[model samples]
Every structure is written in structure tokens, then in C-alpha cells.
Target: MALGKVKELVSSNPVVIFSNKFCPYCVCVKQLFVLKLGVQYKAIELDQESDGSEIQSALAEWTGQHTLPNVFVGGYHIGDCDSKFDLTP
Candidate 1:
């Protein structure tokens, strides 16, 4: 299932971002990782993918929350843009 894939991504990568490219909040999260933290992350832009909605839905089911820029770090669901910013070093 798509949710399984979402979990796999979260577990496998140090940082994972499930986002929508057009969303400013999503953009902010990406910038935080790439610009501020200078870390490479796996950014899955749902808006750009054909099965994005399904993936987003699956992410919600798995993580118990739904929003743009769902962020996972070190296999932990760290939450959205603001949460990601909080984790920035």
C-alpha cells in the first residue's frame, strides 16, 4: 500500500518531506533543511506526482495527522513547517 511506502521512506531516510510545491509552508520547510541546515533530504512533492493525494491520505493514516510538508527526521514524525523550524539547529 501507499502508506507502507510512506513509512518505508520515513524509516529509510534521515529526513523526509512530503509536500506540495505550490505551498509556501512547504517551501519554507525545504529551505530550512537545504539552506539553514545544509542537509540533503528526500522531498516528495505531492502536487507534482500523479498519486500524490493517495500518498497524502496514506501519510495521514500512518502519522495520525494531515498537512502539507509532513516532516520526518531520524524515523520520527516531527510534524509540519513550524515543527521543522523548531528542530533546526
Candidate 2:
């Protein structure tokens, strides 16, 4: 189910942010995309979902990295928050 949700998010949104509401890094990542880059994005708050852990597990399996703010842009895996900074000036 989590995998399905992940796929749906990736396929539907140009920018998908799988985040935890309480996470600082997650908040930062969202700001980078929405505020700095001016790209409209979809953010799924994993911490609010009952199957958030399951989704995180599936993301780890899919991306081979278990970190919050798992970001995907244009259906491409864009790594974590640190990687996002690397894309910026």
C-alpha cells in the first residue's frame, strides 16, 4: 500500500516531497523547492500517516537510502536534503 502511494505521488506530481512534519531537514527541503526554487510541490507528511513507517521502508528499498524528505523531481530520484543543496548555487 505504501509502495502504491509512493508510486502515485511520484507519477502525479512534478515535485514530490515525502516528509515528516516535525523534521527540520524536511522543512528545509520543502522551503528550498517551494520558496527558493519557486517550484510548486506536493508534500506527503509521513509522520501523519498510519503507514508512514511502511512508506519509509518502501522508500528505503526503492532508493536504497532511509532518510526523511525523500525528494523526487519530475519522476526522478533526487536524493536527500544534502543532495538538494548541491543542486543550488
The runs of at least 3 residues in candidate 1 whose Cα sits more than 4 Å from the true structure, single-residue gaps closed, are: 82-89
TM-score of each: 0.88, 0.88
Residue 56 CA error for candidate 2 (Å)?
0.5
How much is 84 displaced in model 1, in angstroms? 8.3
Question: How big is the positional error of residue 6 in model 2, measured in Å on the Cα after superposition?
Answer: 0.7
Per-residue lDDT tens digits for candidate 1, residues 1-89, read 88888988888999999999989999888998999999999999999988899999998898777888898888878898555345554
Task: Show the lowest summed lDDT stretch of 10 residues, model 2.
Answer: 80-89
**C-alpha RMSD values across all candidates:** 2.8, 2.9
Task: Indicate the TM-score of model 2.
Answer: 0.88
The candidate 1 region of ten consecutive residues with least summed lDDT is 80-89
Taking the tens digit of each residue's C-alpha lDDT, what string does model 2 give over 1-89? 78888998899999999999989999998898778999989988998989989999999999997988899888888888666444432
